[model samples]
Structures are given as structure tokens and as C-alpha cells.
Target: MPRGRPAGVPPIGSYTAVGDSFTEGVGDPGPGGWIGWADRLAALLADRHAEHAPPGSFRYANLAVRGRLLDRIVAEQVPRAVELAPELVTFCAGGNDILRPSGDPDLLAERFEQAVAALRAVVPTVMVCTGFDTRGVPVLGLLRGKIATYNAHIRAVADRYDCPVLDLWSLRAMRDRRAWSEDRLHLSTEGHVRVALRAAQVLGLTPPADPDQPWPPQARPLRSQVRRDNIHWAREHLVPWIGRRLRGESSGDDVLPKRPELVPLELPGAVEA
Candidate 1:
């Protein structure tokens, strides 16, 4: 069954996905472009729930906006999410905070905590938070360090709020340069599928029927053009580890595992860059 819908709820269970471009599936084609992982996650959840849950027990709403910041989410998205009163709420945010010139890690964490707290007040069942993908950006050369700091903040917030988090930053895909788009920011189709699969495993839903299928036929040429160096990164480093966490097979570590080789590129004369 799909991930978010509660077992025994009506087939049309409601959900609200709040996040940035990654959640919006920015590069993906059409409205359903692989641009946002949230849509893919929603689809996976619905499809699986349809199959596994008794008839008519899955539905969701994607409220993710492109380029959204943590502050903006509190100002706009959270109120709507409260009104939706979804059975499940997934929060995928923080990339923009890391990208903005004036982004503050402390403020980002505070807002995230507030957002989760607000969401929980409305929907108590499931609240999923996502971390960043710190690979391939020239400006974000300190991506790994920044992500570690930010994820630490997120983990703290999750523990305080009693929510689940999906650590996309430490995933092997973020370490491998090939998993990123040519722009060196957004995810490629393969990256989207990997994220969806991971989310499925987390939500306890069946994996996509064909996990290897590319979203658009045109993406095939793009896929070929990019090197597939980190193709096994997700399977090797992320999947098994996160699978254990989701299944309650292991205790999750508060500190993110290190991948120094995957660290962001350093700029000359930059502090810890």
C-alpha cells in the first residue's frame, strides 16, 4: 500500500506535501515532471495503498512550491496545510535556505521546528521531514558541512516533535557528482526515482513496479550524456541503512555519517570551505 494513508482510513485519505523545488519536481516534464520528489512519493503512496489497503483508502495533496524558503513555508504553506487537515504531512525543505546568500542555519532550524509543531497540532498521524542534497554546486562548495549542520538541527527538531525524517543529504547520491542535473543543483530523473524508492521504503509502501524506468523518454538521452559513476551510491550506502531505520530494525543515529570525499568543493581562502 502507499506510504502515507493510514490503514483503515477511507480510500481518499488526504495529505499535504510542503517543500521547495525538490519537492515540487522542478525538472520533471509536465505537471508531473520529475521536478519534485513529493509528487512521486504521493503517487507511490496512493498506488501502493490502492493495492494493499482495503479499497478506497488513499489520497494526497501536493502543496510544494518551487524555490520556497523555510520562512515562506511558515507564512503561507503551513496555514493551508492546517486547513487541509491531512492524515499525513510530508515536509521537504531547506535547500533554498542553504542556497540563499543570507540564509541562517539557526533560523532555518527554528522555522522547521515551528512548522512541524504546527503541523502536528493539526495532523498527528505522520509527519515526514527531508534533508538536503549537497552535491555539485559551485557556490555551495561547503554543501556537506552546511548540510550536516542543518540536518543536525532537523534531527533535533524531529526528536522534539516526535516525527520521522528522511536524510537525503547523506545519501550516496549526494556524494556522486553524476546524480545531479547538469545545472548541478536539481536531481536528474534517476535521482528522482531513487528518492521515490527510498521514500516508499520509509513509508512501508511497495516499491514502484519498475524502479529503473525513466520518467520521460527524452530523459534517456540526457541520462546517457551524464556519467553514471555514482549509480550504486543509493543502493550501497543509503537504501539498506534507511530501510533498517524505517522498519525499526535499527536505532537511528543522531549524527549523520561522514563522507569527506563527497564534501563540497573548497574555494580558495574560504574558511572550512
Candidate 2:
């Protein structure tokens, strides 16, 4: 069999990711680019390839767009992923959709199921992720219930399809303020790394490192500092997000997928600018 053969292929080779900003690595900006969880996952998978598969056989593509709704993800990215027909596919959607003022959880769940079913029919190893616990996010704490509801639906869907689920809601480590960006909407670089490690474990990769390590203690901001920081965050992130919503625009409006096609995997250090 070929090293990257589909049916009996190892998890390390040929992966495709589809969904929204959460998968796109929004807040975790890097010198190379935005090194989101998906990118980190790719790197981890590539690292493991040396054990079971050819070193250069691992490949990955991320078709996630920031601020995308569930329907748009299915309509646009899923078909492309299907065409690519990777050995593993990871999907995280509905987070952006559920954040809308008129968000409908039940309707979104129905759509989510449809997408999962579609992917499961073709892909051998499909993975779905749950939304994070939002109780720690300032101004977004009230949405925890909503996120929990969506996560429950995601679990049910994953069960029906026999797909591995990266239950982000269950990870207490992610609740730390340090795991998030100032926007409090996306993960920090450490957060993305942790998530990728967890995803690798879920895929039976058993990464060399662990994702559950405790974060170092952070200094509690002063009351005055908290207020000042909140003001700055609102001015920088929240205001622009609200403005985009009002204008019916998205951060990904003119942007293309960071990695559109699957190519031989290259670690950050291995590839030069």
C-alpha cells in the first residue's frame, strides 16, 4: 500500500480542516503567520509521521475563514475538503453562528448534523470540536449556557457518526485567562498549542508532550487596571467586531484560506521565508 493510502492510512498523513476563525487561528498571531490550532495540529501530526509513516508524507490544508457561519462553512469549505479527500478531517463551526443576536441553537444543530453526516460518508477519520466554556470570558459569560447546548448537540452528532470529538468544554485548563487573547474570543498561542496537543491525543497520536500542563500564575490586574484594559479591549476588538456586524461584513471577506492545498508537511523551523 502507498505510504499515504486513504483506507488504512496512518493519522499523520493528509489532513484537511474546515470551519471558522476558531480553526483559523485568529488571536495567535505569529512571525510566519497566524499559527492557529489547525496549524499546530498539522505540525504535531507531521512529527508523529516519522514513527509510522514517511517523514514527508504528511500534508494539510485549512479552509477555515474568520467570522464564518455554519451554513457558509458547509456550503463553501466542505465540498472543497471532499474533493481533496484527505485521510483525516477536522471541523469546528457554529461558534460564529451561535454568537449572532438572533442565533437559533436548534436550527444550527440541525445544519451541523447535516454537515457531519456529509463528511463522515466520505472521510475515514473525521473529527468535530466543541465550543469552549465561556464563563471566564468577560462580557461573554452569559453565553456559556448557549455554548453548552451547542456542545451537547455536537457530542450527539459525533456519536451518530462515530467521530472523535475534541471536547474543549471539558478542558478546565482552557478556562484560564492566559489561554485567551485580549479579545477573549480566540485562543492565545499557548492555547492553540494546547488544543493541538489535545486533538492529537484524541486522534490516537499520543503526542510527545501533554496539553494539560498547568499555566504559570498570572498577576491579578488592579481594579483600575482591569477597567482600563476592558476599555482598551472594547475600543480595539469589540468595537470593530460590532462595526463589522453592522456593516454585514466579516474579517475573512477578502481573505483566502491560509493553506488551500495539501502539500508535504513542513515544520516552522524547517521552512524558511
Candidate 3:
């Protein structure tokens, strides 16, 4: 554990990730159904802490569900995480809320701060995340203002609790079209890798590679192709998302956490950034 941690807080080794689709590995598929940045970051943390702990002792859990509301995360996931009391907790919420038509950043910030304060009380480290810079995303780009407002509050909450911020908004690599999946919502495989690399850096661990590595040069798609792709995207992804919202349904309606417990984590080519 680093020096000056609250006296009773546990040492750093175990980690728990909390949030929605982003942390749940929506866009990045792997050995399992999805392997998001949290899993990748866990592999890096395990490798770095290996010498200091027994084999298989570095544990990790991800309590994120897709399309979850920030209040639900606080009401359900937060308490469970507190019970587990892992040395490190990455509290990422509010993105789903920011997307709602009636989302209020200031109100969400109050709730977010409460969760962070509670987690910080028992966990040696509590990391927070900001929403992505949605300027280049399709429909989401229109709500960039809402996301930005939420991001600002997130930074303030992290600062108040002395927690580190995974400033996704500042990651310039995300602006590229290649960073997202066909839905133009969740990240693509490359996007998850970039996020993981950035997260490792945020945790003060040496990243295996650069988060902002340049993509190979390629010709832009034809204007006609862009129009077809947009139409296809609306039918396949966007329309369904809107329907779900209208019906008050979610992609993760009853989905369980990918990794519900802080057990030993298996390291494989699963997280080669």
C-alpha cells in the first residue's frame, strides 16, 4: 500500500470496477462474451503486483451492467461493493444518466459524490471516470453539452475525495471513427485497448503501450458509403436503443455482473494492449 492511506483501509491488491456498458465490456468481445478496459487494467495491475503478493492473490471484480441508471448503481452496486471492501474501487457511473433526455448533471453529481465518499472511507484507492468526448459520435454528438456538464462535476467529485480521474474526455484517440463499434455507441476492440492503456497510466502503473498510438493510414469512405452506413446504423442499432428507452427497458435488464466476486484472475492474451 502507498503511504498515508487511512489507517483502517486495506492495502492495494484487490480491485472492483463499477459502472454500465463501458466497464461491462460491451464493444470489446474476447474469450468471454465481452472483455472491457477494466479487465485489461486488471491484468496490468496483477502483473505489477505479482512480486508483492502470493500467486493468484491479486483479485478483481466488475459490477457493471449495461444501460444501468446511475441511481440504480448507487442503490444496488455501491452497497455490495462496500461489503466486499476491496482495496481499490473504480466508481464509474452517470454516463447512462447523462444520456437520458431529462438528465441533470448537478443532481447526479451529488449522488456521485456520496458514493465516492463512502467508497473512499474504506477503500485505499477510489478512482472515478468522466464521460467520453462525444463530439464525433453520431446522434450522441448532439448531447455533447450534457456529457460535458457531467464530466465537470465528476472531476470535482474526484478532486474532493482525492481520487484519481480517468479523464476519458481528454483522450483524443477516441475522436477517430475507428474507436467505436458499428453502433457508434460502445467502443470497438481497439477503443477498449486504448482506454485500458490510458487507465493503467491513470493508476500510476507503467502502460504496456501508448494509449494515443496513431492508426494506420486509410482512405476515407465514399460519401455514398457514409450515407448507407448511417442508414444501416439507425436501423440496426440506434432504433433499437431508442425503443428500449421509450419502453423503459435496458440491454442489461437482468444481466449479472461479468465477474461478481474478487477471486483469482486468469491472465492470458486476453489483455495484450
Top candidate by TM-score: 3
Better of 2 and 3 by TM-score: 3
Tell me the tens digit of each residue's lDDT in model 2 across 1-273: 101223454555789999888898888887777878888888877777767876788888999988888888999999899889888899999988878877887789999899888888888878999988887577678788888888999889988988888989877779888888878888888888788878877877656667878888778889999889899999999999889989999888888888889888765752211
User: How displaced is residue 93 in candidate 3, in Å?
Assistant: 0.7
Candidate 2 weakest lDDT stretch, 10 residues? 1-10
lDDT of 3 by residue, 135-240 (tens): 8677898889988988888888877888878889989899889999989889998999999888878777768798988888999999999999999999999899
| Candidate 1 vs. true structure, TM-score | 0.67
| Stretches of model 2 off by over 4 angstroms after superposition | 1-9, 270-273
Q: Highest lDDT: which candidate?
A: 3
By TM-score, rank the candidates, best first. 3, 2, 1
Residue 8 displacement in candidate 2 (angstroms): 10
lDDT of 2: 0.82
Q: Estimate each model's TM-score.
A: 0.67, 0.92, 0.94
Task: Give the backbone clash total of model 1.
Answer: 18
Q: Give each model's whole-structure lDDT.
A: 0.59, 0.82, 0.86
**Model 1 — which ten-residue stretch has the worst lDDT?**
264-273
